[model samples]
Target: MTCRIWGRISSINVRKVVFTAQLLDLTFERVDAGAAFGIVRTPQYQQRNPNSLVPLLEDGDFTLWESNVIVRYLCARHPERGLYPPELQARFDAERWMDWQQTTLNPAGREAFIQLIRTPAEQRNAQALAASVAATQPLLAMLDARLASRRFMAGDTLTMADIPIACEMHRWWGLPLEHAQHPNLRRWYDSIRSLPAASGALDVPLS
Candidate 1:
């Protein structure tokens, strides 16, 4: 089935689904729909996704939203890649990291991204940016510690868990902040970022 993703690449959420789809080697069409692109507020788009969010996935007759869920769904379609992790424990372990990426890591870094990248320098909030950096650095260290023992989040092989976190790293690393060096996390990110499928998904300049 042909898949279509509605979102601009500039969006972290959209990048997550796009990266996952590309990593799975799925043929899909991407339509710009969020931010300056518009269309997300349209009646037709809202009918499919009430929240008017980007990265809405349309696979054949099935429509799914929420970036992480779309990633899991795409990975589920390609079991041979082993990105979805079949074992019970491994799957749940991957799920945990994916949830953490969205809940903890993304939120921690969001304010900084907005203030530094999205907001004008004259209008930026220094306190919010500092708070965001403060909250996110420990998480980066935690990830470094987690990766010190494994090549990937759930294990040695890349799984669904790595997709979102890698995208998060892509965003965090792209920022102009003076980030503490996360050797292990950097190692893991470099390896995945080098994958051929990551071309458009991970390499895009942050906006």
Candidate 2:
């Protein structure tokens, strides 16, 4: 049986899984959920993913949630694809960036996104927005330095690290901020943008 993904296209988390699936050439059906779609709270959906989050993966009898975990599973299942290396050290290196994204970048980015996108303009929290942007700069600088030295986050090869980070990067670049001097980050992002999967799955307007 074919795999199925439950999530809206506009969601960053869902975009990560969709992009990964596209990279692996895996055919899957995607169902809208979360925010505007109320299916996420349904009893059947709750049984599959109690968290009621976007990007739940259902492959045959197996089910999985968490976008990064889903990507890791897909890469592990298709080792020959080279998107997720089987080597322990290399995989660890890629995993490091993924962890960093979850722990460090996403929190900061989400705050900025919520203030700028989700919050009403009249009642938006400028102070909080400023703080979030300040917090994010150092992280972006770190990514810029890493990209300066290597073509991709996990060295020269594009691995799972690129997927999650790229999703965030789309938001970062799309936001109305003065262009910064992260040339390397910009170059790497542009390259990823050129990918067919990235274009199709990730190039959505920020919500």
Q: Each candidate: what lDDT?
A: 0.93, 0.89
Relative to the true structure, candidate 1 reaches a TM of 0.98
lDDT of 2 by residue, 66-126 (tens): 9999989998898888988778999999999998888899998787888888888998898
| Candidate 2, poorest ten consecutive residues by summed lDDT | 172-181
TM-score of each: 0.98, 0.97
**Candidate 2: residue 160 lDDT (0-100):** 90
Top model number, TM-score = 1
- Which lDDT value does model 2 have at 143? 92
Q: Candidate 1: which pairs clash?
A: none
Residue ranges of candidate 2 with Cα displaced over 4 Å: none
